[model samples]
Target: MNTHPAPATRETGGAIAPHLRRLLEFVEPDRDDVCLDVARGRGPMPAALGPQVRHLTAVDAMPAHAPGGHGASGTNGRMSTVEFGTGPVRIADGDTPPAAATREERRPHPLGPDRTLVKADASALPYRDNAFSLVTARFSLYNLGDPEHVLRELLRVCRPGGRVVIADLVRGNLTGPDRDRIERLRDPDHPGTPSIARLTEMITSAGGSIRRLDVFTVERPVEPWLAGSCDDATADRVRRALIDEVDGGPRTGAKPRIIGGELWFTQSWAHVAAEPIP
Candidate 1:
């Protein structure tokens, strides 16, 4: 198994919120239902899904190191900023930082008295068979060395006729230049996201049926993508490559077309709902 930590995009919360909303729209958990958020980094979905479910479980592998230390601190990892919109604009400012921090602070048990956080692996969930009524994972599927094994485990723990929801970025979703930029920066252990067709097959083979699949488009301003991090070199490369893409279309091949707007990149997400066989 790959022990390396995966790189989480700065836009995780923002990019994932809409997809969570959509998943909630379809699953609509009852107050008595048991829900689990697999690979629950900083616990976003659990916060949203907790109120509606009888019990919420947030699980992930124990971090080997803390945000600023060498020892694993459970969920406290490095912070990355995500900016939205065009030139010289900050979607979230100083006040926003506190709010974001507050949100994360509440992450440990955002669902309150009824929720639990577990340090565990996705491929071999510690829960018993048919233990939960609903299971959800976001932007986390690609990190697994065996996504199929993990999906099967999720299905195993879910109750008969219960639901499993997965949200992830598609490999070809980004434009050429942006894709290249990501590929270069991406860690070797970072498994490029799987295609939609492959994901669908994995779910069905595990004795689950697909209910709904949707793609959400998110556009981030170039400046934020470049300047959000502390690393100057990465920021510079991103900035220069983006400029090159703007100047020369496919001719440059260094940048992909900015979809939605001139300075924005696209993230394609697939939300799949599967039901366990009764």
Candidate 2:
């Protein structure tokens, strides 16, 4: 078991392959097994992880997580929309995925019948115990109110000897008050990023044995990141803070820098896989 955390690193182009590959490497899904992706929310997971498994269950807290669904969240200047339906599934942001969805819609869907969308609480999964072989969640911890509880639930639904993986932005060692304030301003639902050490503990406490832990960074232009995510006032505050950090006022460990005349910042993330005690 690897207990020591990896150092922060950086990547560009917003490509999804590297991260998705790392998760697959750790989980190593099989075609005959069922996998659950919690808090999927129209993320890159469905397209990337779906093809490799026998069945993929994608769940989100709200209908808005799907394309054309009710409610919307800012993403690359577009919103996720999904047509919803009535079912036993009920989800809430910070809790989990959706319950009902249209299967035959010709609209640009990344998943097929092999995939299912459910609205349910992450902390209170509606599935039977040991129902899945692999379970995962991506980029959702910062918004979760009780990540530990959710992890335990994920483990609970995972079959014995199965694995659970979580990937999210890790608070840099240099992260401090200024950076936290900016993050909250940009996304009010942001509870705050967690350190790699803290995350390891969360999984282990959930009865998972650590198998792998990898760290890397993703770089993005600052302006676009804050564009639709925040109001003018809050965006201004974030910009000022970034400028100060670039000028050496204080480091947020976000690595704010000017590249090709555009302001950019890097966020570190940790990808972890842990197996349940069989």
Candidate 3:
């Protein structure tokens, strides 16, 4: 099975930063409102999101992997978890050890008293019904057991007319061969990402109205792409396959396009904003 190294924490953050910024503009949270960043990996969004809203609550299913660390077994050491909130953000640190105990802690952003970190599942949020005015999930739904169910839960927790925005990678966004290889190698635990059409249908069926939907594509150099995944033999195979495909020829209608400094790979993405029905 083909495999790639998990993206470096920095690259992961960079990959999603532009997308998150665009979504934030559309969501437009006010200083008096509470916003929740569900499945917040490494607290990247919260760093930008904390100052915009009155309070920002960040939660993850598992404690973020210690930065620069290796594996789930803590072989490379642990990273620090920093809380950033306006009026006391409540953080829930699920099953992972507290950030303090980890050996590889990154310094917390100085956002001050309003942030709370919690260990929680998106489908079964611990907050009260209608506790938040806005909810955002960044590239997380694709990994959940039931993304639609989580969307319903996101809708349920939002106050009437509040908005829930979802940002995720779409299936057609990656290089064609790379995309196929990924699907073949992907574990069952990693559910395939949903297409834009399905996501829209799920949100509408859940009694939420889509206010805006947009797609953005980015092309990255091959080196960075190869560097992003695991460094194992399987990962090497996958990387080679990707390179061969790119150099071999185009099977999918159009030939590969060159962008920036590398042979281009396309990433199709959609951002959907849904408002709950009153």
Model 3, 1-278: lDDT tens digits are 11121232222123433334555655566677699887534545676777778898876643223232110113322111112212211111111111211221244533457878766776777889788988888767654447777788888888875678787766542333445444333222334555667778888887787766665543333344433334456446654555566677434322234444344344455667777876
TM-score, structure 1 vs. true: 0.68
State in Å the error of residue 67, model 2: 20
Instruction: Write candidate 2's Cα lDDT for 43-96 as tens digits.
Output: 656666777789998876432233333011243221222222222111111111
Clashes of each: 2, 20, 31
Candidate 2: 10-residue stretch with minimal lDDT: 91-100
Error of 2 at 250 (Å): 3.9
Model 3, residue 5: distance off in Å is 24
Cα lDDT of model 1 by residue, 37-101, tens digit: 88635645776777777888887532223231100112323112212222211122221111122
TM-score of 3: 0.68
What's the distance in Å from true for residue 266, model 3? 2.0
Question: For each candidate, what TM-score against the reference?
Answer: 0.68, 0.72, 0.68
Please name the candidate that would achieve the greatest lDDT relative to the true structure. 2
Q: Which numbered prediction scores highest in TM-score against the true structure?
A: 2
